[model samples]
Target: MDNAPNRTLLDLQALEDILQQGAVRTLFQPIYDISKQSILGFEALSRGISGTSLEFPERLFCIASEQGKLSELELLCREKAIARFVEQDLPGKLFINVSPNTLLDPSHPKGETLHLVEKYGLSANRVVIEVTEQDKVDDGFLLLKTIEHYRQLGFSIAIDDLGAGYSGLKQWSELRPDFVKVDRYFIDYCDQSIVKKEFLKSIIELAKVTKTSVIAEGIERLEELTLLEKLGIVHAQGFLLAKPARQPPRALEASQVTQLNLRSQSNHNEMSMSVGCLAQIEDAIGQSTRCKDAHKRFEQNKSLMSLAVINAKQQPVGLLHRDQLTEVFAAPYGHALYAKKSVVELMDKQPLVVDENAKLDVVSQQITEQEFDIRRHIIVTRDLKYLGLAPLRDILKHITEEKIRHAQHANPLTMLPGNVAINEAIEQRLRRQNTFSLAYVDLNHFKQFNDLYGYASGDSVIKLLADVTVQVCDQSSCFVGHIGGDDFMVVFDGDDAERLCHQIINQFELQSKAFFTSEHVEAGGYWATNREGQKQFVPLLTLSIGLVRPDLESCNNSHQVAALATDAKKEAKRYRNSYLFVCNRRKPAAPIVRIKTTVHECSV
Candidate 1:
């Protein structure tokens, strides 16, 4: 007889025992942002009968599902979660996970779910139904209608695991969910991937379009949080902000709220919106006087797999969560059947929806903060009918890209235009076909110096170089840009190019002393071994000015001239001292030196 103090993984039998014994529990995990180092929200997780938390939420539920106790376990978890929240009487909405198949069960309505909420003294507004996009629904319309009925009673819905399943743009456009929770996988590395950032940005954009708010989950790092906030994401829920506790957060008093080192209102305001805004969007959606946007409509739904939805006036709404339709739709193109299918047959029974006249800010907050079941798309309409669909991923992408653009244009270290923008600026100069010289400013031995000192010292070197470039360019006819790392580019013409380069070297040579050790500086910048293993002394921070004068002789295209300037800079470096090189590429071996510096003429 194994009378062991049971220490097994939360299996179905154990979960069943826990559920039957009412020993199952709910624990909250804190979500944090890596960038701002702030607390966003807590994710509610299910615990097993063993009186300990499960290793993973998905695994815990998956095992229960395998045992055929999924429905029972979900219901029990809901009840337990509600009771706990009710006991704590927390202010924020309580997120509850529900299976679409189970929630849509006709018998589901008659079940103890609603009774449990009511019994626990919880408001439907305080409860958000979580719907997964990982699975397909048998009856799309029935699913929608069921959730809609609940919405009317004040409970909200949220689309969950957006990037995990077939839940992206299509479901977003059709469901019009009040809230869109970006999948954790999307949020995990968002601080790194631009494509992911673009995808998430699109989700935010769709949210704005469909009158929904976005909640980014799985934020564990501050940089990621900072990026999300900058992208205008309304709410964040992850581990870094705060670890989940048995008790939910209590509403702070005005003073306490102000005093707390939580997310700034301006930051949150940047992310969220007001109900008034949502209400006004009604006119924007219906009055889309651009009624002939059929082409655009088709383009948006080109990816639909099932029945497509349109507005009340019979225009295509978007596609429903195309689980079955994507699988069973009768079509030659597979998704083409949706384009041909009757809106009524393929449409969700009750599409996720929101009124445009609602408070935009409140709605947005509700969206990012609330939990929802089957959070698909958010319908934007004045009178409860949808005007258009909002794809969650697109919305997130737009906002995030906007942030990325801002960050790229504005430097992170010295806060300057990066290489991309520098290239653009050069293109703009070329577009105007201006006679400008491109100056190449580089630190000679930055790596060797920084390696000997520290990264902070390296950063100091960059700042010193940046300051020198700024001072020289701003005071003259040139524009300067950091080409990245130790390289900087300046565009100018005539004697100004050589003049600016000299000014930079003169100034940087002075500033370089502070970051160096007395001995290294006293050696008068002698060559030390680098990874290249050559005697390369910290080349006195200098600029090799490349001047390209365009008259028709050299070439008409500034692109050609810019390339010539690059070659000229290479030539100038051969002199070993700060020098300027002018490219009269049309003339072979043109002027090599002037009093200021040596010039090496290169060809087109």
Candidate 2:
């Protein structure tokens, strides 16, 4: 039993010696940007010295803490990792694990790591200090101060293993890290677990509110990846993505991309339709017309089921039905009783009237609300003037068709027009010979967030963005379409394309910041593993919009507009922040004029 104490001392001595010699090895794991299907960065994981019982990372850290040498050991780990990171000529940020206790060690000077970065010809901007979340942070003030000091020197902070340790939310709120790595617990079975899905969604919501970004750790299944992609998480890491390696890879495996794309296509094909377009209008009859005259018209037009009875000003007053008229006239001596009476005497006063522009689904709901008074033929009007009648059967049929069309042509997630609808809408605009602007919208770093969160959460972000787009654009003058994930198209009649795009980008910037975690806002970016499994810093999500003016005479179709606007979008994305690029490709013979305007630059 006395020998046990001596053995403990020997183990402590070994740990101290290892720390002094800086014998730890660093292995990197890649974090992927799911949307781009590319690597974002790599996390540097520390391993114990070779041929030692402390060879395992968890054991090495635990033993070091037990030996009261955690501060020294962690420092050594950081130094060695940074040195190797520089030695290998890595292309991304280096995520170095840091305990709050290590930063509290007054013996270690502040900015020591910053100086080390300079020694290796690297800037502090390339280093992301991953704060361990397992430990309780008692001295919150001290922790915040230390992190703030590091921030001043350009070192981004990440809260690691969120939802696994004590004070996770507290630490996040206080420190406001650049990245919050969701613990693997919530990610497990998130695809099937409604509870876990809700929890992840809340975390992502919290991050968005704080303007921080999340990193989903330990993703292993294709189902998980598929779910996360739908949730709109852009940053992810797991064995499925890439195991920790000595060098990072540049892109996702081609096979993985192909598989994911096929799955996406399959999922898209499964979407069902809802609602439909406006019903066709039928004619109205004059209220002053005699019953005999109206009866003659109904007899002449066998298909005329009902007609709107209108007043002198062409406003509908009542509905005259052929069946009701026939029933009253068919009665014994009915012609002698009503042959000279006006059509108003027999017309139904309470008729179901709706505007011509109302959606078929909304109109159906209105009709359903009035269970007793469903007009056999609904009266349709333009500007309160009688236009036509839409039969009940036709309305029902249109709604069903609309639902089917929505499923086939609208974005499954946003329920907005997809490529098929967008193409058709653009062609119609061109066919009308109307001057309009076509804006192509894209979300920057959206892939990174989608990789970090699950698809369920990522989808909320996309939906929110869609909502904002729909809200800002006038439905009367503008048509919005979801051009697949994180990309949209808006067609605007009149010269308000620039104004509308600015509003969209501006409104999106305000709403999008809330989607990120606090830490991401503080550092102006998020940390992820690049292709070679090296940590890289990706900027927060921003919008890049490209606008092009459509010429009725010169442009052949919507494809030409998309092609021209794509050039502008590329130029807009080249800037460090959100920007708008306008291309005047109206004249076929004239040179294209690109307008580079800084309408709204999201403060990074």
Each candidate structure's TM-score, on Cα atoms with residue i matched to residue i, is: 0.42, 0.47
Please write out the lDDT profile of model 2 over residues 1-604, one tens digit for every residue: 4687776676677687787687788888878767545555679888876777677787788888776777778778888888888777665467888888888877666767876765665545557889988887778899899999887656778999999998878889999887889999988879999998888889878877776778899998888877876676778988887788767664677667656541211112121222223435656777568888888888998988787887655666678888999998899988788877888678865466666765566577656654424448777767556777777777777667767886788888988879887777777768878787888898887777888867776888889888888877732257788999888888776466787788888888888778778888888888997668888888877889988886788887878777777777888888878899887655434457999987887898
How high is the CA lDDT of each candidate model?
A: 0.59, 0.75
Model 2 error, position 279 (Å): 9.3
* Residue 254 in model 2: lDDT: 60
lDDT of 2 at 529: 79
Number of the top-ranking candidate, with TM-score as the measure? 2
How many residue pairs collide in each prediction?
87, 60
The worst-scoring run of ten residues by lDDT in candidate 2 lies at 262-271
Q: After superposition, how far is residue 250 of candidate 1 from its true place, in Å?
A: 4.6
